[model samples]
Target: MRATIIHGAGDVRIETVPDPVILEPTDAIVRIVRACICGSDLHPFHNKPAGSDPRAIGHEFIGVVEDTGSAVRTVSRGDFVIAPFVWSDGTCEFCREGLFTSCLHGGDWGDENVGGGQGEATRVPQADGTLIPVPGITEDSELLPSLLTLSDVYGTGYHAAITAGVRPGETVVVIGDGAVGLLAVLSAKQLGAEKIILMGRHEARTNLGREFGATDVVSARGEEGIAQVRELSGGHGAHRVLEAVGFLPAYEQALGVVRPGGAISRVGVPQYVEAPAGRVLFRPNVTLTGGVAPVRKYIDTLLPLVLDGTVNPGRVFDMTVSIEDVPSGYVAMDERRALKVLVKP
Candidate 1:
């Protein structure tokens, strides 16, 4: 089988690799149908340490179950399913509490000898807990792109809004206009936020944010961007701030634009260890929250909405590529020429 491997920063390649088989009774082997490049994947593409062994990459995928281990009960061979970025045992205490990302037995793809999603197939641990079956939809349905988003970005964006406690008629500010940020705007709107200010420099991407429910677009950065968001929120800053870019500067913008007593929810994987925690957070009684989205927990909530056409998170995928061209997909996203790239294996 052919799979994607990252030899080092800016070096992604497609090469032949061994096919996957069940290593645990809870596992399933899924033949890839649709997969995608995530914004988080770019972090490693940009700064992965040199001289490390090449490893399989990619996490978001939708596939058909080719086989399942003896212990798998929720899905059978030939079932169409969505694989969350991480696999967790459904029986874990954290999973039961809707925090599958923190499950005691959970782990991410491309580690512990698991095949990555951007391949011919992958071994999905905790099959019953991690793979969500898609009913009544064909493999080629236009909704596949939307269903694919449930694997990560849509669920992640929703996590940002939900964690911040977005409510009806509240003011919300979403930082960034990437896939997650645009979807965060949609998520805030779904939660009934009456005003949404999207901070993004790209006019094309920000335009999508507007359609997603952003009442205003702030193209400036630093103090200027913060000022624009504050003015749009009627001078008090936003009731909730969703930071989708992982950089510290984006976090600082969130800190600047959130009103006192408001919350900041960050779905981006943090790129820094230390951030100002003194007066920036203490003076306002601000609540800082959000982490890796337990997307498995959100699949049920978001799947129905996709099936019903209430939302079209698939719009985030502006480019599609064959498995052999995945390296170019990464470059397109890294260069900001594409919002998100969909992969067809």
Candidate 2:
């Protein structure tokens, strides 16, 4: 079996690795058909120490189930499924409450001792809870990107909008233009936001954002960008703001562009800085919410949209590469040359 492995900072290689097998009663083994490089993968790809033993490097994938453990009932051999980036035990209290990302037994792949889905074959634990079966979707290769979106980006985007409580006729501002940001724009429109403002400089991405339903695109950076968002909302700021980029600047922009009493749904994975609570707590009743997206919760809601052609989140995919060429895929995305990269194994 072959898998993309990150040997160290800026180094990625496709190498042979042992095939996976079902290891738990709730596990399933999947033969990878398609996978993609996530923005999160770049954190380690650029900052992790050099010489760190190569680890499998992808989380988003769609595949055919080759085998399943005795406890797996929702999926079976030969079923086509989408693997959520986070694996969870469906029986947990948190999972029952629609927060599978925080499930008591949920964990991320590609961590120490965890087998990642970025290979020829990989193990999926709690298969019945983590994998979403896509009925009648086996032969369509083009559907791979959209199905893959459910694993992370699209789900996260949906999370941002939902967290912000976007409503019909509300003005929403989405910060960042990564895959998640672009999808946030799509999600806001689908949720009935009458005005969608996207803050990004890249023409390619901002253009796609418009096609996805962004009513306005703000190309200014920093304070200028914040001002543009406010201007679009009649100098009152948006009623809802979606923070899709997890960084201090992006966070500040989200806060600065939302009206008092509005909500800021932050889906970006915070890296090092803590948000200034005082700014939010003391000023206007601003509601703050968000974390890792509970992808499993949105699988049912989003799958039907994809199936019915009401949304095509796959438009964010600007490049497609072979699994062996994943190194370049990562570089392309990291450098902003590609909005999203899909890998075919």
Candidate 3:
């Protein structure tokens, strides 16, 4: 088996690793078919603390079940399935309410001695709750990219829009132009946003945003960008703002373009923690809410669209490489030379 590992900043390698096996009664082993380098993965790729040991990387993948533990009854061997970036016990109260990210028993890949997804295979704990069977499965490699997005990216973009409370015929502005941000534009339109404004400067990426449903693309930055959005919204800010980039500047831009009473739904992993509530969040009377998306909760609502070809988030994969070339995938994404990278095992 081979897996991607990150030894420290700017250092990634594909090394032969031990094959995974079911270690718990509820575990399942999945032979990796497709995986991806996420925008969030770049955080640690470029910012991991110096002198950290090499650890397995990547969390998005879709594959066929090689085997399942005795307690795994919902899915059987040879079933094609997708697992969320995080693992959780479906019986938790928060999971019942569609907030699996906050489940009482939830964790992620690459921890607890679990093999990561961007590899030849992975051992998934809580298989009954974490691994979802892909409906009407066939071995069509073309469908892999789309199903792979359902594992995290599309579901995450869907989360940003849903939490923002995007409404039909309303004005919505999405910040950031990464894969998730581009998909956020698409999700907003699906939810019936009549006017979708995307704040991104990259010509190539913004072009896709327009194709995804962005009626307007604002290339300005700072207050200039905010002004452009305000003008497009007829002097008032957007009815809803989706912050898909978690940096302070991105967060600030989201607040800048949201209507006084509108909401900001963020899905990007926050790089900096918010300070104690202060004047910045007070004067506007706007709602600020978002956290790690409970991707498992939204998979059902999103899978049908992918399976039926209603939406194709797979377009974001600008580059693809063999699983062993994983380090270059990181480089391509980090340099913005690629919108997103896909790996085939």
Best by TM-score: 1
The candidate, 2 or 3, that scores higher on lDDT is: 3
Pairs in clash, predicted candidate 1: none
| Candidate 2 lDDT tens digits, 1-345 | 888888889988888877787778999998888888888888888887887677877888889999999989999999999998988988899999999989899788776555676778788888988888887887466677788899899999999999889999999999888999999999999999999999988999999999999999999978888888888899989989898888888888877888988988989888756567785745788888888899889988999888777889988898999877888888899999988998888
Q: Provide the lDDT at 12 for model 2.
A: 87
Residues 1-345, candidate 1, lDDT per residue (tens digit)? Answer: 999999899999999998899999999999999999999999889988888988899999998999999999999999999999888898889999999999999898999679888888999989998999887667889998999999999999999999999999999999999999999999999999999999999999999999989999999999999988888889999999999999999999999999999999999999999998888898889999999999988888889999999999999999999999999999999999999999999
* Segments of candidate 1 deviating more than 4 angstroms: none
Report clash pairs, candidate 3: none
In candidate 2, position 150 carries an lDDT of 91
Tens-place lDDT digits, model 3, residues 166-194 = 99999999999999999999999999999
Instruction: Give the Cα RMSD of candidate 2.
Output: 1.3
Residue-pair clashes per candidate: 0, 0, 0
Error of 2 at 336 (Å): 1.0
Model 3 clashing-pair count: 0
